[model samples]
Target: MINKIGKITIYVNDQEEAKKFWTEKVGFVVKFEQEMAPGMKWLEVGPSEEEFTTFVLYNKEAMKAQNPSVSVGHPSILLSTTDVEKAYEEMKENGVEVGKLMAMPYGKMFSFNDQDGNNYLLREDK
Candidate 1:
């Protein structure tokens, strides 16, 4: 009964800043954005128009208040890239904090941190 992954929520201190980081720094496009409530806004961003899954940038404080049991910690996300070296260099040029590229049995990969200090893995599938 399971189809495909829909969306992943990323709780951030400032939604606007997160959006900028993803779009400007990470090179993702804004899929959707709208005012959900008085103080809350819904924002969805992804790598491309055809991408099935997207990241929803939500307000951290608002989410925590809405559901105390919900985990607000950073989620580990792994992204695929066509060229690990190019991706790594681009991220570094964009001022993103990234780790050195490593060679694994599977492929080449690296880690980078977003503005919220959330770490994400970038790998070139072999």
Candidate 2:
């Protein structure tokens, strides 16, 4: 039987920079980190220590070299927040590239980019 989401893999150019962006800018915590191999590391980060799912920041070049069949692309991740405006403002103040907030019948949402330029949506459900 299927359970909840385990982890999401995000291939990045620089693991350290990505880690800083997620932890410092995006306010994610480092759940786990270890050296998988020489010049390769396995890093897991999430919103909090108690969170179930995490984002695994993998070394893109190393991963691609190890697995040629690996598919690396931008993933549309929708993050829920209690206040979309506040989240957007915080992200912008933290120097994160953010898109304009949009209002929809469902909720208010905005998009922000990580250091690696991967865009993620933040929504405040009404």
Candidate whose lDDT is highest: 1
| Model 2 Cα lDDT, one tens digit per residue, 1-126 | 989999998889999999999999989999999997778789999999999999999888887788889888867788888988988888998999999999998899998888888888899965
Q: Candidate 1 at residue 43, lDDT? A: 97
Cα lDDT of model 1 by residue, 1-126, tens digit:
999989999999999999999999989999999998899999999999999899999999999899999999988889998899999999999999999899988899999999989999999974
Looking at model 2, the pairs that clash are none
Which residue window of length 10 is worst by lDDT in model 1?
117-126
Residue clash pairs of candidate 1: none
Error of 2 at 78 (Å): 1.0
Relative to the true structure, how large is the alpha-carbon lDDT of every model?
Answer: 0.94, 0.90
List residue ranges in candidate 1 displaced over 4 A. none
lDDT of candidate model 2 versus the reference:
0.90
